[model samples]
Target: MLTKEAFNALLKTLEEPPENIKFFFATTEPQKVLPTIISRCQRFELKRISNELIIEKLSAISKDLEREIEKDALYQISNFSEGSLRDAQSLLDQIFCYSDGKITLEYVNNALGFIDPDFFFELDNQISKANTSFAFEFVNKVHSLGKDLSYIIEELIEHFKNLLIIKFNSKTSKFLSETILKKYVLSSALYQEEELFYILETLTQATILHKNYFKKIHLETVMLKIIKSKNVLSLDILVKKVN
Candidate 1:
C-alpha cells in the first residue's frame, strides 16, 4: 500500500483515543491535502532558505566540482530557479554535466544548446544547394540529439529574444557575438520588425502547447508553421534564400 493510504488508515486507528500516539505530515503543497486530516494535527511552518544561503551552497558545490562559477551563470540559475535552493542546485548539476564541469558564460550557452551561429550562417550559405529533404533530415537529427521538440522551439525563441535585445542595445547584451548575428540582422531586416516579433510570439506559444502534451502531429505543425513564417522554405530553401 501507498504510504499515504497507510497513513490514512493509521489516522482511523487514532480517531478513537490512543494515548501518546502522534503523526505528522510535511508537504510543500498543503492545500492539496485533506483539511480534516490537518485539523487533527499541530502545524508548524518552515521558513524557506534565503537566496544568500542558496548561493553559498552553490558556491560550495562549484568548489567541489573544481569549476569557476561566473556571475552570469549564477544569474542564469537564479533567474530560472525562482529562489529554490534545490532547483538552483539541480540547474547547476545539469549545466556541469552538460558542459563537463568547465563553467563559463559560453559554457552556460553551450549547456542550453542554443542555436549555433556557424550552423545558421552555413544554413544561409547552403540555401542554394540544399533541397527540402535536408530540412526534414535536419529536424530528425535534432530529434536524435535527445532534445524534446518543445525544448528546441524554446531555445529558438530564447536566441531570438537575445538577438532582439542586442539589436536594441548592442553594449548591454552580449549573450551572442555581434559578428554572428549580423547575418541574421541582414536577413531579418528584409522582414518588418512586427513580423519577427510575431514569429517569436508564435514560437513561444508553440513551446507552451507542445510541453503541455507530447503530440507528434502538433510538433510537425509547429515546425511547418516556423518554416512558413520564418521564410525558411525548406532546409534547402533556407540555404538558397540566404546564399
Candidate 2:
C-alpha cells in the first residue's frame, strides 16, 4: 500500500539515492506495492516451507526443549500451519504452554476444541460405503456431542486425503497400522479419484457457506450429497452383462 505522502518522500531518495545508503523493502503482498517501486527494486520471492521439513525441525526443537510432543501432535500442527513455519512454531508454542511439556494428539485436539480424527474416519467410512442411515446417525451423535461442524469438515478433507494416499501406498504406520492401512486401501477402492475430488469440493464449498452457527439441515444435506454423490463409480465390484 503506497500512500501518496510515503511514495512522494521515497521517490526523491530512490531517484537520487546516496551511494552509502541502501534501501530494502519487503512485503508479503507485492501486488499492493507500487509498480514503479517494483520496477526499481531487485525482487526476491520466498516459497512456502514444506510440512515434513517443518515437522522435522519442530521435533528437534521439542526434544531440545524437553517437550516430548507426540508424532501425531506434530503432524496436526504441521497440517494446521499449511506450510507457514512461523504459524506451526506458534501453534507448537501454544501447545507447549498448554501441555507444560507432555504433548499428545488427544491433548492437542482437546486444547483446540477439535474432535478426534477417528470420528472423521468413521464418517468417511460410512460415506464411502454409501451408508446413508449410519451416516445420518453419526451426524446426530456429532450434534449431541456438540462438535464444531466447520472443524469436522476441515478434518474430513484431510481424512479423504489420507484414504487417497492409501490407494497408492503400501506402507504401515506407527499409528495407522498395516491392518488399518490395508482396510483404508480397500475402502479407497470404493471411490474414484474424481469422486473424491468432487466430495472434497462439495464439502469445502458447503463448509464455507455456514455462518457462526451450526445448522443440522445444512449438515444433513451434505450427508445426502456424500451418500448419493453423482461422481461415484463402482470400482470394487464387477458386473458382467448377460448374453
Candidate 3:
C-alpha cells in the first residue's frame, strides 16, 4: 500500500529507522527518485553480467539443455544481446522455441538477416542507371542494416579490386567464378589497368581513414570522390590531400 504521500513518509523512516528493522529498495530507473532520498541511500549499480555467468545461470535453470546452451551458440547470442543478461536469456528462450530445443549458427543467422543481398546488386546497377536517387537510397539502406560503414567501404573496394584484377590478366581470370568474372571482364575494359589500380589504392587508404576518426558523412564524401575520380588517369596527382 504505497501511495505518493505514504512514499514520502519513507524519508522519515530512513532518517530514523526503528530498532531491529531492515529495508531494501530496488528500481530500474533511479532518476525518478528525489535527490535527497538518493543521497541518503547506498547506491549499488549492477554491472552487465558476463557471457560465462549468463551461461552458468541458464545451465542451472535448464539442467536438461545445459550442455547445448553452454556451447558457442550462447556466446553469439550474448554478443547480439549487447551485454544484457535478461536480453540474452530472452533471446535464448526464443531460439529454443524456434530451434526445437537445439541451438546452431544457421538458426541464429536466419533469426537475424540484418543484411540484404540486393545491396550488392543495386550498387552494381548504379553504373548503368546513373541515378542519384538510387545511389542515396542504396547507401542509406546499407547504413540502416546496423553494419559498420567501414565494412561497407571495404566491400566496395574489394568489388573494384576483383574487377581490376580481372582487367589486367586474362589467364589469371580463372580465379573468379564464370558469371561474376564475366561481368568484371567486361567492366574492366572501361579503364586502363594502371588507373584502376590507383583507384583501388585510394579506396584502400580511404577504408583505413574510415576506421580511425572519420564520421560517416566524411567517409561517404571520400567514397563519392573516389567513384567520381574513376575518370582521372594519374593516381599520383589525384591524392594530393593524402601527401
Candidate 4:
C-alpha cells in the first residue's frame, strides 16, 4: 500500500506525465486506491482462472517434466491454488520435489497439510449413522495427525455445503471430481435438505466461536450436537405423519 504522500505524488505524475511514458496500474483492491488516481487511469477486472484450465496447465507442466501425477492430485492442487496459475505452478514444483515416484492424492494431502477428502466422507458417514465412537475416533485421528481443528471445522462447513448442493441440484455437481461426486450422490440421500442446512448453520457458529477460544473438546461437543440433532421436518411431512 502506498502512503498518502506517495499517492499525491503519483496523482501529480498521472496529471502531467513525461513524454512517451505509459503508466499501468494493477490492483486486487481498487477501492483502496485514491479515486482521483483511478479517474486518470483505465481499469480492467480479471476473472479468476477456472479450475479446469488450471488443471489442464498443471497436467501439461507435469508431462513436460516427465513426472507422473494423479488427476485427483492435480484437482487438489488447482483448488488449493484458488485462481492463481503462478501459485498452482509453484505448488506443483514443491510437490514434485516432495515425491520420488508417481504423485498420488494422499501424497498431495500430506505434502500440503491438507485433509484428505476421504476423512470428510468418513466423518460424514459416521455422523449420519450416529456412530459416536467412530466420530470421536476420527477427531482423535485428525488431532494425532496435527491437523488444525479450526481448519477442519471450516472444511466441514464446505463438505456439508457440497452435500446440500448435491441434494438440491445434482447438475451443478460437475464442479466436483468424479470420485467425490459419486460419494456425494450416495451421501446426499442420507439427509434431508433441511438437515444439511442445519448442519451448515451449526458448523458456522462453531467457526465463529473457534476464533475466540478453541479446543479439541469444543470440537467434540459440536460433533455431538450435530450427531444428536433432531431431523428438521417440514409441516407437510409432519401432517402426513399425523395421519
Candidate 5:
C-alpha cells in the first residue's frame, strides 16, 4: 500500500520511465491501489489452483523424493493448504520430515492437530440419540485435548452441512470418498431435510454468539440445545399423522 503523497511522487515515473526501466506491482486487493497507478500498468489476475491439480503436483513431488504417501493424505494436505501451492509444498516437506515410514491420514491429522472426521460423525450420532451425557463428556474430552472450541463448532457446522447435502442430493457428493460417502448415507437417514435445516440454523446462530462471548460453557450449552431440538416433520409426515 502506498500513501497519497507516495502515489503522487511515483505517478511521473510510471508515466514516463527511463528507456530501459519497467515497473511491476502486485496486490491481492487491486481496488485498494490508486486508479491512476492501475491505469498505468497492465494487470493480471491469478485464480486459485484446484485441489486435483494440487494433489497431482504433490504426488509428483512425493515420487521424486522417493517418499510413500497415501492419496487420502495428499488430499488432506491440499484441503488444508486452501489452494496455496507454496503452502501445500511446505506442509508436505514438514510432514515428510516428521514421518519415518509411509505417511497416512492419521499422521496428517496428528501433524495438523485436526480432529478426525469420525469424531464429528459420532457426535452427530449421540446428538440424534439425544444422549446429553455423551455429548457433554465428548465436549470435555475435546476440551481436555486443547482443541479450540470455536474451531470445533465450525467443523460441526460443516459436518452437518455435508449431511444436509447428502440427504438432499447424494449424487452431488462426488467430493467425498466411497467409504465416507457410505457413512454419510447412513447418517443422513437419521434426520429429515427440515430437521437438518433447523440444525444448521442453530449451529450458525451459535457460531455468531460464540464469537461475541467465547467460552466452553457456551459450546456445551449449544450442544444441549441441539441435542434437545424438537423434531421438524415434513409435509408428508404431517399429513400421515393427520390421517
Candidate 6:
C-alpha cells in the first residue's frame, strides 16, 4: 500500500508508461489493491490446483520412489495441502520418512496426529443414535491421543458443512469417491438441513471463543451440545454461550 500522493505519482507514470516498461503485482486479495491501479493493468487470476491434479502428482512421486501409498492417503495429503504444491511436497517428504516404504491411513494419522474421517464417522453414528456417553468417550480418547482439539473442531465444522452441501446438492457427491460419498450420504440422513446449519454456526463461533486454555474441555462441551441436540437448536442460545 502507498500514500495517496505516492499512488497518484505511480498512476501518472503507469497511465503513460515508457516503452518496454513492465510492472507486476500479485496479491491473495486483489480487490483490496486499489481499483484505480487495477484499471491500468491486465489481470490474470491464478486458479487453485485441483485436488485431482495434486493427488496424481503425489501418486507419481510415491511410486517413482518405490513407496507404497494408498489412494485415500494421497487424497488426504492433497486435501490438507490446500492446493499448494510446495506444501504438498513437504508433507510427502515427512510422510516418506515416517512410512516404512508403505503408507496406510493409520500410518498417516499416527505420524501426523491427524484426526481421521473414521473418527467423524463414529461420532456421527453415536450422535445419530443419541449416544452422548459415546461422544464423551470419543472426545476423551482424542484428548488422550494428543490430537489438536482446535483443529478437530474446525475439521468437524467442515465435515458437517460438507454434509449440508450434499444434503441439498446430492449430485455434489459425485466429485468424491463412492466410498467417501457413501459416508457423507449416510451422515447427511442424520441431520436436518437447518440442524446442520445451526451446528456449523455454533462450531464456527466456538473456534474463536475457545482458542484459549482448556480447549479440550471446550471442544468436548460443544461436541456434546451438538450431538445431544436432536432437534433444531436455538441459534440465540448457542451464540450466547459462544460469545
lDDT of 2 by residue, 1-243 (tens): 668679878887898999999898877788877777778889899898876788899999998897787777887777678788989888888878766657888898777677776676676667666777876786687777778665667666767777766656646332353444565676777776667777877777887635835467678777788777744544442242221
The model with the greatest lDDT is 4
TM-score of each: 0.48, 0.75, 0.42, 0.91, 0.85, 0.75
List the candidates ranked by TM-score, beginning with the highest.
Answer: 4, 5, 6, 2, 1, 3
Show pairs that collide, candidate 2.
none
lDDT of each: 0.60, 0.72, 0.62, 0.83, 0.82, 0.79
Candidate 5 segments whose C-alpha is farther than 4 A from its true place:
1-10, 209-214, 230-243
Q: After superposition, how far is residue 149 of candidate 3 from its true place, in Å?
A: 1.1
Residue pairs whose backbone atoms clash in candidate 3: none
- Give the alpha carbon lDDT tens digit for every residue of 74-169 in model 6: 777777788887788899999898657678867766766777787888887887787878757877887888877778777788788889989998
**lDDT tens per residue, model 3, 1-243:** 355576689889998999998788887677777766788889999777765676566666556665364344554566567668788778777777776556554466447543432355445455334444554565577677666776666666766776677766855754333454566666766656665666677777776755567556656665565555545547555575468
Estimate the lDDT of model 3: 0.62
Worst 10 residues of 2 by lDDT: 234-243
TM-score of 6: 0.75
Candidate 6 Cα errors over 4 Å, as ranges? 1-43, 233-243
Against the true structure, candidate 1 reaches a TM-score of 0.48
Instruction: Name the best candidate (by TM-score).
Output: 4
- Model 1 lDDT tens row, 15-41: 775788566568888775566567777
How does model 1 fare in lDDT?
0.60
Clash pairs, candidate 5, are none
Worst 10 residues of 6 by lDDT: 172-181
Show where candidate 4 strays beyond 4 Å. 230-240
| Residue 233 in model 4: lDDT | 62
Window of ten residues with lowest summed lDDT in model 3: 113-122
